[model samples]
Target: MTFYAFAKRIVSPILKKMYRVEVKGLEHFPEQGGVLLCSNHIDNMDPPILGVTCPRPISFMAKAELFNVPILSGIIKKLNAFPVKRGGNDREALRTGLKVLKEGKVLGLFPEGTRSKTGKLGKGLAGAGYFALRTNAQVIPCAIIGSYRIFQKVKVIYGKPIDMSELREKKASPEEATNLIMTHIQQLLNENR
Candidate 1:
Protein backbone atom coordinates (compact mmCIF):
# COMPACT_ATOMS: atom_id res chain seq x y z
CA MET A 1 0.00 0.00 0.00
CA THR A 2 1.04 3.58 -0.57
CA PHE A 3 2.18 5.53 2.46
CA TYR A 4 -0.86 7.76 2.28
CA ALA A 5 -3.08 4.74 2.08
CA PHE A 6 -1.27 3.19 4.99
CA ALA A 7 -1.50 6.37 7.00
CA LYS A 8 -5.12 6.94 6.10
CA ARG A 9 -6.04 3.46 7.16
CA ILE A 10 -3.91 3.34 10.30
CA VAL A 11 -2.66 6.72 11.47
CA SER A 12 -5.82 8.60 10.51
CA PRO A 13 -7.85 6.69 13.07
CA ILE A 14 -5.33 7.47 15.76
CA LEU A 15 -5.27 11.16 14.94
CA LYS A 16 -9.02 11.44 14.97
CA LYS A 17 -9.32 9.58 18.23
CA MET A 18 -6.42 11.30 19.94
CA TYR A 19 -7.21 14.88 18.96
CA ARG A 20 -10.97 14.59 18.56
CA VAL A 21 -10.55 16.41 15.26
CA GLU A 22 -13.70 18.00 13.95
CA VAL A 23 -13.73 18.87 10.29
CA LYS A 24 -16.23 21.36 8.92
CA GLY A 25 -16.95 22.28 5.29
CA LEU A 26 -15.32 19.17 3.93
CA GLU A 27 -17.56 19.46 0.90
CA HIS A 28 -15.65 22.56 -0.08
CA PHE A 29 -12.71 20.50 -1.32
CA PRO A 30 -13.06 19.86 -5.02
CA GLU A 31 -13.37 16.23 -6.01
CA GLN A 32 -10.48 16.57 -8.46
CA GLY A 33 -7.88 18.86 -10.05
CA GLY A 34 -4.87 20.77 -8.79
CA VAL A 35 -5.69 22.59 -5.55
CA LEU A 36 -3.63 24.72 -3.19
CA LEU A 37 -4.77 24.32 0.42
CA CYS A 38 -3.80 27.36 2.50
CA SER A 39 -4.14 27.48 6.24
CA ASN A 40 -3.14 29.66 9.17
CA HIS A 41 -0.17 28.18 10.97
CA ILE A 42 -0.74 27.62 14.66
CA ASP A 43 1.58 24.77 15.57
CA ASN A 44 3.62 21.87 14.23
CA MET A 45 0.52 19.68 14.41
CA ASP A 46 -1.41 21.58 11.72
CA PRO A 47 -0.11 19.66 8.71
CA PRO A 48 -0.87 16.16 9.96
CA ILE A 49 -4.25 17.27 11.24
CA LEU A 50 -5.00 18.68 7.82
CA GLY A 51 -3.80 15.55 6.11
CA VAL A 52 -6.15 13.45 8.17
CA THR A 53 -9.05 15.88 7.86
CA CYS A 54 -8.81 16.41 4.11
CA PRO A 55 -10.59 13.87 1.95
CA ARG A 56 -7.88 13.95 -0.67
CA PRO A 57 -4.20 13.18 -0.43
CA ILE A 58 -2.19 16.34 0.26
CA SER A 59 1.50 16.84 -0.41
CA PHE A 60 3.50 19.44 1.52
CA MET A 61 6.80 21.32 1.60
CA ALA A 62 8.52 20.67 4.91
CA LYS A 63 11.66 22.39 6.17
CA ALA A 64 14.89 20.94 4.77
CA GLU A 65 16.14 20.47 8.30
CA LEU A 66 13.49 17.84 8.98
CA PHE A 67 14.77 15.74 6.12
CA ASN A 68 18.25 15.68 7.59
CA VAL A 69 17.13 14.38 10.96
CA PRO A 70 17.73 10.75 11.78
CA ILE A 71 14.75 8.61 10.68
CA LEU A 72 12.30 11.52 10.29
CA SER A 73 13.18 11.91 6.63
CA GLY A 74 11.78 8.51 5.70
CA ILE A 75 8.55 9.16 7.56
CA ILE A 76 7.97 12.63 6.06
CA LYS A 77 8.85 11.47 2.57
CA LYS A 78 6.40 8.64 3.07
CA LEU A 79 3.77 11.20 3.93
CA ASN A 80 4.35 13.02 0.60
CA ALA A 81 6.37 15.87 2.06
CA PHE A 82 9.38 17.31 0.24
CA PRO A 83 12.06 19.52 1.78
CA VAL A 84 12.12 23.32 1.54
CA LYS A 85 14.68 25.69 3.01
CA ARG A 86 13.41 27.67 5.96
CA GLY A 87 13.47 31.51 6.42
CA GLY A 88 13.79 32.31 2.71
CA ASN A 89 12.59 31.46 -0.72
CA ASP A 90 13.84 28.04 -1.69
CA ARG A 91 13.67 28.12 -5.47
CA GLU A 92 13.83 24.37 -5.81
CA ALA A 93 11.12 23.88 -3.22
CA LEU A 94 8.85 26.35 -4.99
CA ARG A 95 9.41 24.58 -8.28
CA THR A 96 8.57 21.22 -6.71
CA GLY A 97 5.33 22.71 -5.34
CA LEU A 98 4.37 24.00 -8.77
CA LYS A 99 5.09 20.63 -10.28
CA VAL A 100 2.78 18.93 -7.74
CA LEU A 101 -0.07 21.27 -8.72
CA LYS A 102 0.52 20.90 -12.45
CA GLU A 103 0.25 17.17 -11.97
CA GLY A 104 -3.24 17.71 -10.47
CA LYS A 105 -2.29 16.91 -6.88
CA VAL A 106 -3.21 18.86 -3.78
CA LEU A 107 -0.40 21.03 -2.39
CA GLY A 108 -0.74 22.05 1.28
CA LEU A 109 0.92 25.29 2.38
CA PHE A 110 1.11 27.58 5.37
CA PRO A 111 0.98 31.03 3.80
CA GLU A 112 2.03 32.53 7.08
CA GLY A 113 5.24 30.61 6.25
CA THR A 114 5.97 29.40 9.76
CA ARG A 115 4.36 28.16 12.92
CA SER A 116 2.72 30.94 14.92
CA LYS A 117 4.27 30.69 18.35
CA THR A 118 1.85 33.29 19.67
CA GLY A 119 -1.16 31.30 18.45
CA LYS A 120 -2.11 34.19 16.19
CA LEU A 121 -2.04 34.28 12.44
CA GLY A 122 0.92 35.93 10.80
CA LYS A 123 1.12 37.85 7.52
CA GLY A 124 1.46 35.56 4.56
CA LEU A 125 4.74 35.23 2.73
CA ALA A 126 5.00 35.23 -1.11
CA GLY A 127 5.39 31.58 -2.02
CA ALA A 128 1.66 30.78 -2.03
CA GLY A 129 0.86 33.77 -4.21
CA TYR A 130 3.60 32.84 -6.65
CA PHE A 131 2.23 29.34 -7.07
CA ALA A 132 -1.37 30.49 -7.40
CA LEU A 133 -0.45 33.04 -10.06
CA ARG A 134 1.67 30.66 -12.06
CA THR A 135 -0.56 27.57 -12.11
CA ASN A 136 -3.96 29.18 -11.57
CA ALA A 137 -4.61 26.37 -9.15
CA GLN A 138 -7.87 26.57 -7.25
CA VAL A 139 -7.08 27.83 -3.74
CA ILE A 140 -8.82 26.41 -0.69
CA PRO A 141 -8.60 28.66 2.34
CA CYS A 142 -8.70 26.80 5.65
CA ALA A 143 -8.43 27.56 9.36
CA ILE A 144 -7.36 25.20 12.12
CA ILE A 145 -8.21 26.11 15.67
CA GLY A 146 -7.42 24.55 19.07
CA SER A 147 -4.60 22.42 17.71
CA TYR A 148 -1.74 23.94 19.65
CA ARG A 149 -2.34 21.50 22.46
CA ILE A 150 -2.16 17.76 22.07
CA PHE A 151 -5.34 15.76 22.61
CA GLN A 152 -7.39 18.92 22.37
CA LYS A 153 -10.64 19.20 20.49
CA VAL A 154 -9.27 20.57 17.22
CA LYS A 155 -11.46 22.06 14.53
CA VAL A 156 -10.70 22.58 10.86
CA ILE A 157 -12.94 24.77 8.77
CA TYR A 158 -12.49 24.85 5.04
CA GLY A 159 -13.64 27.91 3.18
CA LYS A 160 -14.80 27.87 -0.41
CA PRO A 161 -12.18 27.84 -3.10
CA ILE A 162 -10.85 31.29 -4.06
CA ASP A 163 -10.65 31.95 -7.77
CA MET A 164 -7.84 34.07 -9.24
CA SER A 165 -9.23 34.36 -12.77
CA GLU A 166 -9.37 38.15 -12.51
CA LEU A 167 -5.60 38.14 -12.79
CA ARG A 168 -5.55 35.77 -15.75
CA GLU A 169 -4.74 38.63 -18.06
CA LYS A 170 -3.07 41.06 -15.71
CA LYS A 171 0.15 40.52 -13.85
CA ALA A 172 -0.34 40.48 -10.09
CA SER A 173 2.41 41.27 -7.65
CA PRO A 174 3.23 38.29 -5.45
CA GLU A 175 2.65 40.34 -2.35
CA GLU A 176 -0.78 41.35 -3.58
CA ALA A 177 -1.75 37.76 -4.29
CA THR A 178 -0.39 36.59 -0.96
CA ASN A 179 -2.47 39.08 0.96
CA LEU A 180 -5.56 38.19 -1.00
CA ILE A 181 -5.33 34.53 -0.08
CA MET A 182 -4.33 35.26 3.52
CA THR A 183 -7.33 37.54 3.89
CA HIS A 184 -9.63 34.66 3.08
CA ILE A 185 -7.91 32.50 5.69
CA GLN A 186 -8.13 35.27 8.27
CA GLN A 187 -11.83 35.68 7.54
CA LEU A 188 -12.41 32.00 8.20
CA LEU A 189 -10.66 32.34 11.53
CA ASN A 190 -12.77 35.35 12.43
CA GLU A 191 -15.97 33.43 11.85
CA ASN A 192 -14.92 30.80 14.39
CA ARG A 193 -15.10 33.49 17.05
Candidate 2:
Protein backbone atom coordinates (compact mmCIF):
# COMPACT_ATOMS: atom_id res chain seq x y z
CA MET A 1 0.00 0.00 0.00
CA THR A 2 1.03 3.58 -0.52
CA PHE A 3 2.28 5.71 2.32
CA TYR A 4 -0.91 7.75 2.38
CA ALA A 5 -2.99 4.67 3.06
CA PHE A 6 -0.43 3.35 5.49
CA ALA A 7 -0.38 6.55 7.48
CA LYS A 8 -4.16 6.71 7.59
CA ARG A 9 -4.28 3.17 8.91
CA ILE A 10 -2.07 4.13 11.81
CA VAL A 11 -3.65 7.49 12.46
CA SER A 12 -7.30 6.53 12.13
CA PRO A 13 -7.60 4.47 15.31
CA ILE A 14 -5.60 6.96 17.29
CA LEU A 15 -7.82 9.86 16.24
CA LYS A 16 -10.93 7.85 17.06
CA LYS A 17 -9.81 6.79 20.50
CA MET A 18 -8.29 10.10 21.46
CA TYR A 19 -10.75 12.55 19.93
CA ARG A 20 -13.79 10.40 19.17
CA VAL A 21 -13.87 11.73 15.61
CA GLU A 22 -17.15 11.03 13.86
CA VAL A 23 -17.92 11.64 10.19
CA LYS A 24 -21.20 12.15 8.41
CA GLY A 25 -22.49 12.63 4.85
CA LEU A 26 -19.68 10.64 3.36
CA GLU A 27 -22.05 9.73 0.53
CA HIS A 28 -21.47 13.24 -0.72
CA PHE A 29 -18.05 12.08 -1.86
CA PRO A 30 -18.11 10.65 -5.36
CA GLU A 31 -16.48 7.28 -5.85
CA GLN A 32 -14.66 8.53 -8.95
CA GLY A 33 -13.77 11.79 -10.66
CA GLY A 34 -11.89 14.81 -9.40
CA VAL A 35 -13.27 16.36 -6.21
CA LEU A 36 -12.32 19.45 -4.24
CA LEU A 37 -12.89 19.02 -0.52
CA CYS A 38 -13.27 22.51 0.97
CA SER A 39 -13.34 22.71 4.74
CA ASN A 40 -13.22 25.16 7.61
CA HIS A 41 -9.92 25.39 9.48
CA ILE A 42 -10.09 25.19 13.22
CA ASP A 43 -7.14 23.23 14.58
CA ASN A 44 -3.90 21.76 13.31
CA MET A 45 -5.42 18.29 13.49
CA ASP A 46 -8.21 19.20 11.06
CA PRO A 47 -6.46 17.91 7.96
CA PRO A 48 -5.52 14.56 9.39
CA ILE A 49 -8.97 14.14 10.92
CA LEU A 50 -10.58 14.70 7.54
CA GLY A 51 -8.04 12.50 5.83
CA VAL A 52 -8.62 9.46 8.00
CA THR A 53 -12.41 9.88 8.03
CA CYS A 54 -13.02 10.43 4.34
CA PRO A 55 -13.39 7.37 2.17
CA ARG A 56 -10.80 8.42 -0.37
CA PRO A 57 -7.23 9.53 -0.15
CA ILE A 58 -6.81 13.32 -0.18
CA SER A 59 -3.96 15.37 -1.58
CA PHE A 60 -3.55 18.58 0.42
CA MET A 61 -1.44 21.73 0.21
CA ALA A 62 0.68 22.72 3.20
CA LYS A 63 2.28 26.07 3.86
CA ALA A 64 5.68 26.22 2.15
CA GLU A 65 7.42 26.90 5.45
CA LEU A 66 6.45 23.44 6.69
CA PHE A 67 8.51 21.99 3.86
CA ASN A 68 11.68 23.54 5.31
CA VAL A 69 11.75 21.17 8.26
CA PRO A 70 13.85 18.10 7.48
CA ILE A 71 11.85 15.11 8.76
CA LEU A 72 8.44 16.80 8.53
CA SER A 73 9.03 17.74 4.89
CA GLY A 74 9.77 14.16 3.98
CA ILE A 75 6.74 12.79 5.87
CA ILE A 76 4.22 15.28 4.54
CA LYS A 77 5.52 14.77 1.03
CA LYS A 78 4.91 11.07 1.32
CA LEU A 79 1.42 11.80 2.64
CA ASN A 80 0.47 13.57 -0.61
CA ALA A 81 0.94 17.05 0.81
CA PHE A 82 2.52 19.75 -1.37
CA PRO A 83 3.89 23.17 -0.50
CA VAL A 84 2.06 26.42 -1.27
CA LYS A 85 3.26 29.96 -0.58
CA ARG A 86 0.59 31.52 1.64
CA GLY A 87 0.45 35.29 1.28
CA GLY A 88 0.99 35.80 -2.47
CA ASN A 89 0.14 34.13 -5.70
CA ASP A 90 1.96 30.83 -5.99
CA ARG A 91 1.58 29.75 -9.59
CA GLU A 92 3.43 26.49 -9.08
CA ALA A 93 1.12 25.46 -6.23
CA LEU A 94 -1.90 26.38 -8.32
CA ARG A 95 -0.51 24.33 -11.16
CA THR A 96 -0.02 21.34 -8.85
CA GLY A 97 -3.63 21.62 -7.64
CA LEU A 98 -4.86 21.77 -11.24
CA LYS A 99 -2.81 18.75 -12.11
CA VAL A 100 -4.32 16.79 -9.22
CA LEU A 101 -7.83 17.74 -10.31
CA LYS A 102 -7.11 16.87 -13.93
CA GLU A 103 -5.97 13.45 -12.78
CA GLY A 104 -9.37 12.95 -11.00
CA LYS A 105 -7.88 13.01 -7.51
CA VAL A 106 -9.32 14.50 -4.34
CA LEU A 107 -7.68 17.75 -3.23
CA GLY A 108 -8.41 18.82 0.34
CA LEU A 109 -8.21 22.54 0.97
CA PHE A 110 -9.00 24.97 3.75
CA PRO A 111 -10.49 27.88 1.83
CA GLU A 112 -10.11 30.11 4.86
CA GLY A 113 -6.32 29.79 4.24
CA THR A 114 -5.42 29.46 7.91
CA ARG A 115 -6.59 27.94 11.16
CA SER A 116 -9.05 30.07 13.11
CA LYS A 117 -7.93 31.10 16.58
CA THR A 118 -11.54 31.70 17.61
CA GLY A 119 -12.64 28.29 16.40
CA LYS A 120 -15.14 29.92 14.08
CA LEU A 121 -15.39 29.98 10.31
CA GLY A 122 -13.49 32.73 8.59
CA LYS A 123 -13.33 34.42 5.20
CA GLY A 124 -12.40 32.16 2.36
CA LEU A 125 -9.66 32.70 -0.17
CA ALA A 126 -10.30 32.40 -3.90
CA GLY A 127 -8.13 29.36 -4.54
CA ALA A 128 -10.88 26.79 -3.97
CA GLY A 129 -13.30 28.68 -6.15
CA TYR A 130 -10.63 29.17 -8.78
CA PHE A 131 -10.08 25.43 -9.01
CA ALA A 132 -13.80 24.73 -9.28
CA LEU A 133 -14.10 27.23 -12.10
CA ARG A 134 -11.06 25.82 -13.89
CA THR A 135 -12.07 22.17 -13.68
CA ASN A 136 -15.11 19.89 -13.80
CA ALA A 137 -14.45 18.71 -10.26
CA GLN A 138 -17.30 18.92 -7.78
CA VAL A 139 -16.77 21.07 -4.68
CA ILE A 140 -17.85 19.38 -1.44
CA PRO A 141 -18.31 21.61 1.57
CA CYS A 142 -16.99 20.08 4.80
CA ALA A 143 -17.28 21.25 8.38
CA ILE A 144 -15.43 19.94 11.40
CA ILE A 145 -17.20 20.49 14.67
CA GLY A 146 -15.91 20.45 18.26
CA SER A 147 -12.55 21.42 19.67
CA TYR A 148 -9.58 19.05 19.48
CA ARG A 149 -9.51 18.31 23.18
CA ILE A 150 -8.66 14.79 24.20
CA PHE A 151 -11.77 12.58 24.50
CA GLN A 152 -13.89 15.30 22.93
CA LYS A 153 -16.56 14.29 20.44
CA VAL A 154 -15.31 15.85 17.22
CA LYS A 155 -17.45 15.55 14.11
CA VAL A 156 -16.65 15.96 10.44
CA ILE A 157 -19.65 16.56 8.23
CA TYR A 158 -19.54 16.64 4.43
CA GLY A 159 -22.22 18.52 2.57
CA LYS A 160 -23.43 17.99 -0.96
CA PRO A 161 -21.56 19.47 -3.88
CA ILE A 162 -22.02 23.21 -4.32
CA ASP A 163 -23.66 23.94 -7.68
CA MET A 164 -21.09 25.76 -9.76
CA SER A 165 -22.96 25.46 -13.04
CA GLU A 166 -23.78 29.14 -12.98
CA LEU A 167 -20.22 30.22 -12.32
CA ARG A 168 -18.57 27.79 -14.71
CA GLU A 169 -18.95 30.20 -17.62
CA LYS A 170 -16.87 32.83 -15.79
CA LYS A 171 -19.99 34.84 -15.15
CA ALA A 172 -18.98 35.20 -11.47
CA SER A 173 -15.61 36.05 -9.98
CA PRO A 174 -13.61 33.53 -7.94
CA GLU A 175 -14.23 35.52 -4.80
CA GLU A 176 -17.95 35.38 -5.45
CA ALA A 177 -17.75 31.64 -5.92
CA THR A 178 -15.79 31.41 -2.68
CA ASN A 179 -18.62 33.21 -0.93
CA LEU A 180 -21.03 30.55 -2.08
CA ILE A 181 -18.69 27.80 -0.92
CA MET A 182 -18.26 29.44 2.48
CA THR A 183 -21.99 29.88 2.79
CA HIS A 184 -22.54 26.19 2.37
CA ILE A 185 -19.85 25.40 4.90
CA GLN A 186 -21.37 27.79 7.40
CA GLN A 187 -24.75 26.17 6.98
CA LEU A 188 -23.24 22.77 7.70
CA LEU A 189 -21.52 24.11 10.76
CA ASN A 190 -24.67 25.68 12.05
CA GLU A 191 -26.78 22.60 11.56
CA ASN A 192 -24.30 20.03 12.78
CA ARG A 193 -22.49 21.76 15.59
Candidate 3:
Protein backbone atom coordinates (compact mmCIF):
# COMPACT_ATOMS: atom_id res chain seq x y z
CA MET A 1 0.00 0.00 0.00
CA THR A 2 1.03 3.61 -0.51
CA PHE A 3 2.18 5.67 2.44
CA TYR A 4 -1.13 7.54 2.62
CA ALA A 5 -3.15 4.34 2.45
CA PHE A 6 -1.01 2.83 5.17
CA ALA A 7 -1.22 5.93 7.32
CA LYS A 8 -4.99 6.12 6.87
CA ARG A 9 -5.37 2.48 7.78
CA ILE A 10 -3.51 3.10 11.02
CA VAL A 11 -5.02 6.48 11.90
CA SER A 12 -8.65 5.87 10.92
CA PRO A 13 -9.37 3.22 13.51
CA ILE A 14 -7.78 5.28 16.24
CA LEU A 15 -9.89 8.30 15.32
CA LYS A 16 -13.08 6.25 15.29
CA LYS A 17 -12.35 4.94 18.75
CA MET A 18 -11.48 8.40 19.99
CA TYR A 19 -14.50 10.14 18.50
CA ARG A 20 -17.06 7.32 18.62
CA VAL A 21 -18.16 8.12 15.08
CA GLU A 22 -21.17 6.46 13.47
CA VAL A 23 -21.41 6.53 9.70
CA LYS A 24 -24.45 5.56 7.62
CA GLY A 25 -24.79 4.98 3.87
CA LEU A 26 -21.13 4.10 3.41
CA GLU A 27 -22.32 1.59 0.82
CA HIS A 28 -23.67 4.50 -1.16
CA PHE A 29 -20.08 5.48 -1.97
CA PRO A 30 -18.93 4.29 -5.36
CA GLU A 31 -17.02 1.05 -5.13
CA GLN A 32 -14.43 2.31 -7.67
CA GLY A 33 -13.24 5.15 -9.90
CA GLY A 34 -13.17 8.94 -9.62
CA VAL A 35 -16.10 10.63 -7.83
CA LEU A 36 -16.82 13.98 -6.21
CA LEU A 37 -17.90 13.78 -2.57
CA CYS A 38 -19.86 16.95 -1.74
CA SER A 39 -20.70 17.64 1.86
CA ASN A 40 -21.85 20.37 4.26
CA HIS A 41 -19.21 21.99 6.43
CA ILE A 42 -19.80 22.01 10.18
CA ASP A 43 -16.34 22.32 11.66
CA ASN A 44 -12.62 21.90 10.94
CA MET A 45 -12.92 18.26 11.97
CA ASP A 46 -15.36 17.50 9.14
CA PRO A 47 -12.71 16.80 6.49
CA PRO A 48 -10.59 14.45 8.56
CA ILE A 49 -13.64 12.66 9.92
CA LEU A 50 -14.98 12.04 6.44
CA GLY A 51 -11.54 11.12 5.17
CA VAL A 52 -10.81 8.57 7.89
CA THR A 53 -14.28 7.00 7.76
CA CYS A 54 -14.67 6.70 4.00
CA PRO A 55 -13.17 3.73 2.19
CA ARG A 56 -11.49 5.86 -0.48
CA PRO A 57 -8.86 8.57 -0.41
CA ILE A 58 -10.77 11.86 -0.44
CA SER A 59 -8.67 14.93 -1.28
CA PHE A 60 -10.19 18.21 -0.14
CA MET A 61 -9.49 21.86 -1.02
CA ALA A 62 -8.19 23.34 2.21
CA LYS A 63 -7.66 27.06 2.69
CA ALA A 64 -4.27 28.35 1.60
CA GLU A 65 -3.53 29.78 5.02
CA LEU A 66 -3.54 26.35 6.63
CA PHE A 67 -0.80 25.27 4.26
CA ASN A 68 1.42 28.14 5.38
CA VAL A 69 1.74 26.60 8.83
CA PRO A 70 4.78 24.35 8.69
CA ILE A 71 3.66 21.45 10.85
CA LEU A 72 0.00 21.56 9.89
CA SER A 73 0.88 21.77 6.21
CA GLY A 74 2.89 18.59 6.40
CA ILE A 75 0.01 16.78 8.06
CA ILE A 76 -2.49 18.16 5.56
CA LYS A 77 -0.40 17.13 2.59
CA LYS A 78 -0.01 13.62 3.96
CA LEU A 79 -3.79 13.43 4.20
CA ASN A 80 -4.10 14.19 0.44
CA ALA A 81 -5.34 17.69 1.03
CA PHE A 82 -4.58 20.68 -1.27
CA PRO A 83 -4.63 24.43 -0.78
CA VAL A 84 -7.21 26.92 -2.03
CA LYS A 85 -7.52 30.64 -1.34
CA ARG A 86 -10.45 31.69 0.82
CA GLY A 87 -11.46 34.90 -0.93
CA GLY A 88 -10.77 36.06 -4.53
CA ASN A 89 -10.63 33.74 -7.51
CA ASP A 90 -8.68 30.56 -6.83
CA ARG A 91 -8.23 29.22 -10.33
CA GLU A 92 -5.16 27.27 -9.35
CA ALA A 93 -7.10 25.42 -6.69
CA LEU A 94 -9.86 24.66 -9.17
CA ARG A 95 -7.32 23.43 -11.67
CA THR A 96 -5.70 21.26 -9.02
CA GLY A 97 -9.07 19.76 -8.05
CA LEU A 98 -9.82 19.00 -11.69
CA LYS A 99 -6.44 17.36 -12.09
CA VAL A 100 -7.12 15.08 -9.12
CA LEU A 101 -10.43 14.01 -10.67
CA LYS A 102 -8.75 13.52 -14.01
CA GLU A 103 -6.32 11.17 -12.31
CA GLY A 104 -9.37 9.09 -11.24
CA LYS A 105 -9.16 10.06 -7.57
CA VAL A 106 -11.96 11.17 -5.27
CA LEU A 107 -12.27 14.89 -4.45
CA GLY A 108 -14.18 16.06 -1.37
CA LEU A 109 -15.78 19.50 -1.47
CA PHE A 110 -17.73 21.69 0.93
CA PRO A 111 -20.18 23.62 -1.25
CA GLU A 112 -20.83 26.05 1.58
CA GLY A 113 -17.28 27.48 1.04
CA THR A 114 -16.68 27.68 4.81
CA ARG A 115 -17.64 26.15 8.13
CA SER A 116 -21.09 26.79 9.56
CA LYS A 117 -20.73 28.02 13.13
CA THR A 118 -24.37 27.28 13.93
CA GLY A 119 -24.16 23.76 12.49
CA LYS A 120 -26.69 24.92 9.94
CA LEU A 121 -26.06 24.51 6.22
CA GLY A 122 -25.14 27.49 4.07
CA LYS A 123 -25.61 28.37 0.41
CA GLY A 124 -23.63 26.30 -2.02
CA LEU A 125 -20.68 27.50 -4.08
CA ALA A 126 -20.61 27.02 -7.85
CA GLY A 127 -17.25 25.27 -7.92
CA ALA A 128 -18.72 21.87 -7.09
CA GLY A 129 -21.47 22.22 -9.65
CA TYR A 130 -19.06 23.42 -12.30
CA PHE A 131 -16.77 20.51 -11.61
CA ALA A 132 -19.67 18.10 -11.92
CA LEU A 133 -20.83 19.63 -15.19
CA ARG A 134 -17.35 19.81 -16.66
CA THR A 135 -16.24 16.33 -15.80
CA ASN A 136 -19.59 14.55 -15.93
CA ALA A 137 -18.45 12.93 -12.69
CA GLN A 138 -20.85 11.44 -10.16
CA VAL A 139 -21.64 13.92 -7.37
CA ILE A 140 -22.16 12.07 -4.09
CA PRO A 141 -24.21 14.17 -1.68
CA CYS A 142 -23.21 13.76 1.98
CA ALA A 143 -24.51 15.05 5.31
CA ILE A 144 -22.51 15.35 8.54
CA ILE A 145 -24.39 15.75 11.80
CA GLY A 146 -23.29 16.48 15.39
CA SER A 147 -19.74 17.27 14.32
CA TYR A 148 -20.02 20.74 15.74
CA ARG A 149 -20.54 19.34 19.21
CA ILE A 150 -17.47 18.23 21.11
CA PHE A 151 -17.44 14.74 22.67
CA GLN A 152 -20.60 13.85 20.76
CA LYS A 153 -20.98 10.81 18.58
CA VAL A 154 -20.94 12.26 15.09
CA LYS A 155 -23.09 10.89 12.28
CA VAL A 156 -22.34 11.04 8.56
CA ILE A 157 -24.89 10.11 5.90
CA TYR A 158 -24.00 9.56 2.27
CA GLY A 159 -26.79 9.90 -0.23
CA LYS A 160 -27.04 8.48 -3.72
CA PRO A 161 -25.14 10.29 -6.47
CA ILE A 162 -26.83 13.15 -8.25
CA ASP A 163 -27.13 12.69 -11.99
CA MET A 164 -25.70 15.68 -13.83
CA SER A 165 -27.04 14.50 -17.19
CA GLU A 166 -30.49 15.69 -16.20
CA LEU A 167 -29.18 19.17 -15.52
CA ARG A 168 -26.76 19.18 -18.44
CA GLU A 169 -29.42 20.44 -20.80
CA LYS A 170 -31.06 22.83 -18.39
CA LYS A 171 -30.70 26.60 -18.91
CA ALA A 172 -29.88 27.21 -15.30
CA SER A 173 -26.99 29.49 -14.44
CA PRO A 174 -23.99 28.34 -12.43
CA GLU A 175 -25.47 29.86 -9.27
CA GLU A 176 -28.74 28.06 -9.88
CA ALA A 177 -26.99 24.78 -10.39
CA THR A 178 -25.09 25.33 -7.14
CA ASN A 179 -28.32 26.06 -5.31
CA LEU A 180 -29.85 22.85 -6.66
CA ILE A 181 -26.89 20.90 -5.38
CA MET A 182 -27.20 22.54 -1.93
CA THR A 183 -30.93 21.81 -1.90
CA HIS A 184 -30.23 18.10 -2.34
CA ILE A 185 -27.61 18.21 0.40
CA GLN A 186 -30.06 20.02 2.67
CA GLN A 187 -32.75 17.40 1.97
CA LEU A 188 -30.42 14.61 2.99
CA LEU A 189 -29.42 16.43 6.17
CA ASN A 190 -33.04 17.15 7.05
CA GLU A 191 -34.15 13.56 6.44
CA ASN A 192 -31.41 12.20 8.65
CA ARG A 193 -32.12 14.68 11.41
Q: Model 3: residues >4 Å from true position, as ranges?
A: 147-151
Model 3 lDDT tens row, 32-130:
777889999988888888988788888999989999999989988988889999776799998998888878889999998999978889888888877
Clashes of 3: 0
What is the per-residue lDDT of model 2 for residues 1-193, given as tens digits with 9 covering 90 to 100?
Answer: 9998999999899998899888899988899999999999999998889989999999999999999999999999999999999999999999999999999999999999999989889999999889988999999999999988999899999999998998987578889989999999999999997
lDDT of 3 at 129: 79
Local accuracy of candidate 1 as per-residue lDDT tens digits, 1-193: 8878888788788888888888899899998999999999988888888988898999998889899897989999988999999887788998899999999999999988788988788999989889889996789999998854567788899999987877645888878888989899989989984
Q: Cα deviation of 46 in candidate 2 (Å)?
A: 0.6
Q: Estimate each model's TM-score.
A: 0.95, 0.98, 0.93
Candidate 3, residue 44: the lDDT equals 84
Clashing pairs in 2: none
Off by over 4 Å in 2: none
Residue pairs that clash (backbone atoms under 3 angstroms), model 3: none
Q: Whose TM-score is higher: candidate 1's or candidate 3's? A: 1
Higher-ranked by lDDT: 2 or 3:
2
The lDDT for every candidate, in the order shown, is 0.88, 0.93, 0.84
